[model samples]
Target: MALAQRLFRTKPTEQIVAEGGHGEGGELRRTMSLWQLTLFSVGATLGTGIFVILGQAVPKAGPAVVLAFVLAAITALFSALSYAELAGSIPVSGSSYSYAYATLGELVAWICGWCLMLEYAVSVAAVSVGWGEYLNSFLEGLFGWSLPAAITHSPGQDGGVVNVTAILIVLLATWLLLRGASESATANAVFVLIKIAVLVFFCVVAFTAFRAGHFSPFAPMGVAGVTAAASQVFFSYIGFDAASTAGEEAKNPKRDLPLAIILSLAIVTIVYVLVAVAAIGAMPWTDFDPERTEASLSYIVNLATGATWPGLIVSFGAVVAIASVVLTVIYGQTRILFAMSRDGLIPHIFQKVNPRHQVPVANTLIVAAFISVLAGLVPLGQLAEATSIGTLFAFAIVNIGVLVLRYRSPDLPRSFRTPLFPATPVLGTIFCVIVMAGLAGVTWLAFGLWMLAGLICYFLYGYSHSRLNTEVPR
Candidate 1:
């Protein structure tokens, strides 16, 4: 009975938020402002997906992929509202993990953190692979030369050795992170500007050749196809929670986190809808080949403009866009690990901040090295589904956490609350599960195995090591 009770004991919210600054090793500097936080979320969420995912998804739903974007955004908004409320109530660095720990229990919190570790690591590695493709394209266009496929492509692909370019980009982001959070945030903002600019430019150019004929078969595959595409494209919005992970760093987390979360989602959704309209309007949906237009937006712009320069520019922007994605995701990853480490759920080394940088250097380095290896050698094209499942699982938990908190601590000072309360969170959870149902069976198998491993690790190490667990007597 004691063990079961211990397993489900909720950590005090005051303790979690209060301890944010007084880490075991050192304090993380609270330097980020509202706009910086907003841009951080934007940079993290808007990646090469808008450039690549549209081609594949468009074929599934036809021009209705625009509706797919809206559906996915609505699904994400449920969880985003939950996150905003929780982050406002308990401003800290752990994102859903911290929220779960406070509202649910130590065991659930450990699982949430573990899932996040997988989500961010796999996400950064996946973006790195896409970055390699665009980097090669940019080089080929400018210098008329590109790296041999053996080094640029992942192992097991056309006699390839390893994706050295992907590993390089991961290392580059790691170096920037070691510089400090404010520095990395600034760099990410610049990259975000470049990506948005390119997308805006594409919309302008592609609309020049827009034809109403593309909308003829708008619902080519019907509502089922739209839902399926929405499920797949939901991964594109995974980083909306990035601001919540930076709670400790935000100058005014309660005010900024919620605004950043909502604003970033609105901005990314608008960009996605416009890009979808432009892409489909410029070319027939039947011609948007996933294999042929790996860089979909760039391909459409090239076809519409009948010029190589525009495509080359789009590719260059993609390269820059992916770099920012890698930066922001890795930033969130390190912060999550930092929170776990500070709570004694993991090694203290992860929480140890560098005196000069005010960042968890060791934690960042460890995460970067692991993801670099994955980017270098693994063929992660099929594993993107795994990333989606992990994210959806996290989203579902955040939604529940909101409901639990409202019941447990109704008076908690939440700067922002989900307006519909029970209904919003309930819908969020249901929508996320619906999306998860669309993933392949193999992905579910892989996620289950991963969670099982996390449970074992928690029982062996996390349960005993956790600060909350230590408070209970043997």
Candidate 2:
């Protein structure tokens, strides 16, 4: 193939389907049902961002932070529709990477995969970095004893050598995943239910202190602030498409994956808006400090009830819930790499599944090791924005992918069709661009550097060995 042809060569849909269970190590075990897939996505999306980012977002948008969440959800809804349609049509473990390959071409597919690497790894690491403070909060609240601050916090957050608690949470989640996806999904389902209940409990408590006047002059900073906060909070919706990464492992991916994608987004949107409404109604947005966002809900509960125990319960719930985020996002990162590896874009080590457990054992461990370092040692506060930008970029690609595939293969069997056809997808792409515009200059710089590195890696490695270019042993 000429260089240009190699760069833009598309993967055939029939071949993508045929290669479903014929990867390098072995096929992913198909065990996930509709609800399990839904919970996987729920566990990923209803994550540390809402639990923490609310304090940060609220300060920017004031009481209209409620609107910020709604706006972010609206943006996500457009992408979710595209995801639902494409995931159902081209169900595969690669998620948007595979979609882009079958639609856009080899180069865009590699970039999409690279963007996913940044989105999943950095976001999960950021969440794990915050997991420590909550773990200590839960511990101190329950037993009146906490891990030494030296071990419990990342540097700059506290005078700590390492965030042992952060690494510990990642390790625990990794072990669960190593056992198998079924076990991991079961545990994540439990985590999702508990966190949902805790969030509801917080709403109940906060409403007790609700003041009608707290919402006056709702958009205190007006449209600009709300849009900026919407951009920031949009990161909260990053993992709604996580179920698509498990397509090879889903029992009926065509029907269930799209349902899980849409259903999980709906569930997350409702919970986030309810919590934001309760929060703003209970306390003035002026009191929200962006710096102290880790326990915003628990703090609200304590402030409302003037009782520490309820807040402590809230803290414990956040602890488990945040751990659930770590588990699911790490699973997402590993699976994305697994798909890339099978396509000869990365080392085959990532695709090597353990025979006994039917999981990518090495892939999980490698991803966990990098995440542990990033969470335990790095000051990741600024880098969180990078995830939002990366996610938005991938979302734009998927929206575009839907359009390309529809025109190229009109007869493709689609279990779910995006409402409004071209309008939905075009708007999805436009909305993603709008949100990406809200991100900071530093975030754009980070994204640019990241994408530059991805291109370098692709030219050096992925371009030379892609299965689309040269025959890759299956």
Candidate 3:
């Protein structure tokens, strides 16, 4: 085959679906129901972002931050519809990676997979770093003492060395995933419930102290500010990709994956809007201190009730919430590699599944170890921005994939389709680009380096070993 032919060769849809479960030790077992699938996405997404987003975004958009969340949700809704359509039709472990392979070909599929690596892996590390800070707050609130800053903070920050709690949480998530998908989902459901209840409690308490005046000059910062904040808030909606990634494990993938993706986004947006309203109601947006963002939600609760206990509850909830993100994102990271490995794009180490547990044992552990090191030792302030850009890039490609597949295979069966045909996907791609444009120059530079590295790796190994021309038994 010519070089370009090999690079752009599309994987047959029938073969992609046929090879769904095969791997090194054994095939992945289907144990996830629609509920578990939905919660997994919820657990991955509903993290400390909302707890801190108010402090960070509220100042940017003022009381109209609520509108920012709505705007972000609308942009995500466009991509979510595309995700739903492709997820329902394709239904594989790779999510957008697989979708791209079936439409855009090997190089684009590999690039999409590469972007997911940055999205899931780097976000896991960034969120875990925040976990240590919340753990200290919870400890201090309940016992009047905090973990030593040295052990709790990452290296090069203050007198800190390694973030012990950050590493501990990643290791804990690794152990949970090693157990099995069903077991991990069950534990995530419990964590999700706890975090949701805590947010609800804050809403109830803040409502009593509600002041409508805070929302009077809601557009204090104008449309420009609201648009900027929406770009930041849109990242919080990133984890619904977890639902699409779980396609191979879902019991009724074609029917349930689309539902889970859309349903999870709906639940997250509702929670976000309610909490945004409550936080602003309890305190003036002008008073939101960006310096203490991670404690923003709990800080509002403390000020509202004038008690240490309520704030403590919120802090404790944050610890659980960040830990939940670590678990689910790790699961997502491993599964992406699992799909790539099976396609001969990456090393086979990721392809090895534990036959009895029906999970990628080694893949999970390796990912956890790498993420823990980043969380414990690296200062992730700038590196974390890459997560947003990488995710937006993958989403745009998926939206394009939907447009291509619909044109190429009009007869292909689809469980769900994006409404408005080309408009849906066309807008989805445009929205993704708009968000990507809002990202910082440093983020774009980092993403560029990551993609360069990925392209080099693809040519060095992936192109020669791709399974497009290789026959495998289904």
Best by lDDT: 3
Cα deviation at 100, candidate 2, in Å, is 0.8
Candidate 1's clash total is 0
lDDT of 3 by residue, 278-372 (tens): 98999998999989888888888889998988999999889989988998999988988999999999989899989989999988988988998
lDDT of 1 by residue, 107-163 (tens): 888999989988999878988976777888999888899888888888998767988
State residue 61's C-alpha deviation in candidate 2, in Å: 3.0
Which residue window of length 10 is worst by lDDT in model 1?
379-388
TM-score-sorted candidate list, best first: 3, 1, 2
Model 3 vs. true fold: TM: 0.97
Every candidate's lDDT: 0.88, 0.88, 0.90
70-94: candidate 2 lDDT, tens digit per residue? 8888889999999999889888889
Per-model TM-score, in order, reads 0.97, 0.95, 0.97
Using alpha carbons, what is the TM-score of model 2? Answer: 0.95
Better of 2 and 3 by lDDT: 3
